[model samples]
Target: MTTLMEKAHAGVVTSEIKRVAASEEVNAETVRKLLADGFLVIPKNINSKSEPIGIGKLMRTKINANVGTSRDNVDIETEVEKARTAEKYGADTIMDLSTGGDLDLIRRRIMDAVSIPVGSVPIYQAAGESIGNMSSDDMFNAVRKHANDGIDFVTVHAGVTQSSFERLKRSDRILDVVSRGGAFTISWMKHNCMENPFYSEYDYLLEMAREYELTLSLGDGMRPGCINDASDRAKFEEFIILGELVKRAREAGVQTLVEGPGHVPIDEIGLSVTAMKHLTGNAPLYLLGPLVTDIAPGYDHITAAMGGAVAGMHGADFLCMTTPSEHLALPDVADIREGTIVTRIAAHAADLTKEGVREKAREADRRMAVARRELNWNRQFGCAIDSEKAKMIHARSRNADTCSMCGELCSIKMMREVMKK
Candidate 1:
């Protein structure tokens, strides 16, 4: 069985590529060429039996919603509801980061509930079990189990090597290590006086990913935690290793996506995207928030959306949403909706920078302008990404001919009336 990359290399267009192209509004041949060249990835494991989603160059920006239970919360039904809600609100992909309850059952239930591609970080399970006793074999087994369970992709932090840890130690930053998986691996490696299992045995992991046709999202284990830590030695060092691993994975017939920073300032976001693209040879760059600010705890979703919009516009292929629950606790249904919708807004905003995406957005905006001029509040609300929110907000102002904020000063209506004379 040819992997997507292998099939692209062989000049055969896979069904996944066609489906992705159609969804992304790109030429099938274009997606094929990008896949063949390792510049794009369509992460749909052959065993997944889920709808394929594309992430990479020249495609519309994609958003991924992280849903799952932590040690504190472990209700499978609630997690499943979150998954369904994520899909409903427009998450192109979902990652099950459940570290609590029956891990396998949670994953299976989430996968069963949604048709979108589902991903998982296997190390979470490995670390969850023994906490301190998990060996390299334990980590490997966890990965194999996820693959066998048909996870579309697995985020393997195969970049944090012994040498990288040395750099991390030598160069301190505001946030030493922001990634949960990275912290787990680094602690284990330091305690065991050994290298990270995922780093040391990456090929073995790649072979497993290949057998199941799973894409490896090279996790940014040393991602910056604050603006002060953005793009420091530890972050770049891990990226260098990730670049090498990406080449190795593609060579071995496994798809790969490169994960990026945690918290980055507005000014540094574009550079981070460019650096990751250059380092990973343009393999789909999946970024987490690159959260522009550290101060907004309850409103990290907005911060993430702001950063996600910039990252996507600059070159980040996939945006991982930071829910309102981020830095606090697990999100409920409302948080899920808020996070997904905000991230979608970011994705669409970024899409405007793409070739035809602006035209689409401009068309919508034009319709909005016309709607306001005609006092068509229904059309104005209908054109909104969150129509329910728009309707509610509009209704709260007594359904005024003009929005409450600018009621008597409605620009379009005023301008039209002035022009009529």
Candidate 2:
């Protein structure tokens, strides 16, 4: 059987690409070209019957919600609810970074519950107990376990090689090695006095990926943690390795997505995405918050959206939504809903700027313009992305047609009345 990449190369549009194009409201050939060029990827394992979700260039920017349990918080029920909340609010995908009790069961249950593409970082399970005991074999076994369980995508920290560590030692960043997976791999390398197994034994990983047809999310282990650490030596060194791994993976017939920066200042986000695209040859870039500011603990979602909009508009393919619970605690159901909606808004805003991106958002904005001209509250709500929230907040304001901020002297409403003949 031909992989999606092969089928695409042969000019055969697979069902996955077709579905993605239909969802994005673009031509299937556009999607096929993106896939062939390694700009877009449909993460669906061969053995798994899960539906495909596209992430990359020339498509609607997709958002992914991270839902999992920490050791202190191990409620499978709550995680499932968060997953459901994410789906309801508009998360294109979900990554189960579970490290708590019953890791395998939690993942399987989440997969069964959600129709969206599911992703997992296998190293989390390998190093869940302690970073000391996490050997290469442990990591490999965990990835295979995830593949056997039908995870649509697996994040492998294959870029944090020994050479990258050498680069990190000379650099002085505010938060050195903020990625948990990167920390684990670096610790393992220092302890064993050996090279990174993921880099050394990449073919074995590629074979596993090819067998399951799993999309390898080449994890950004050396990504900057703080705004000061953005675009440092450690980050680029790992990226060079990731680019090589991406070329090799494509040769092995396995799909790939390149994970990107941890946190970056607003001005630097564009440069970060552009550099990654140039280095990695435009492979799908999945970014964390790339949070613009260091402050705003409770409003990281807003901070993330600010940066995400820039990243998506520049070149990023996927936006990982940061909840209000970010840098604090595990997000509950409400947090997931808010995070997903906020990120979706960011993605849509960015899509408007991107060439040949989503049309619905722009069309909705056009409808809202018409509604404001006609003084139609119902139409305004109908055109809103979060109509329920808009309606509820408006209802609490004491003004039926006008919000409390504007009241009876609403400019738009007043303008409509004055302009009427």
Candidate 1 lDDT by residue in tens digits, 1-421: 6677888989988898999889878889998998888778888877788998778887778899999998888899999999999999899999999999999999999999999999999999998666589888988999989989989999988898899899999986867997888988898988899988888878898878878888899999999888888889888988889999988988887889999988989998888888888988888999998799999999999999999999988888799988998989889978999999999999888887865456766677789878877988899888888898988877878636877787787787788888995
* Model 2 RMSD, rounded to 1 decimal: 1.5
Q: Model 1: which residue pairs collide? A: none
Reference-based TM-score, model 1: 0.96
TM-scores of all predicted structures: 0.96, 0.96
Instruction: Note the residue pairs that clash in candidate 2.
Output: none
Error of 2 at 352 (Å): 1.2
Global fold similarity of model 2 (TM-score)? 0.96
Provide the global lDDT of candidate 1 against the true structure.
0.88
Ten contiguous residues with the weakest lDDT in model 1: 354-363
Candidate 1 ranges beyond 4 A from true positions: none
Residue lDDT tens for model 2, 1-421 = 5678877877989899999899888899989888877778999987676778888877788999999999999999999999888988889899999989999999999998898989998888998678888788998999999999999999888999889999999999878898888888999899889888888999999888878888999999989888888898899988988999999988877789999988899888888899898888889999987789878999999999999999998988899999998999888898999999999989888888887775766787889989877767789888887889988877777766667887888898888778889
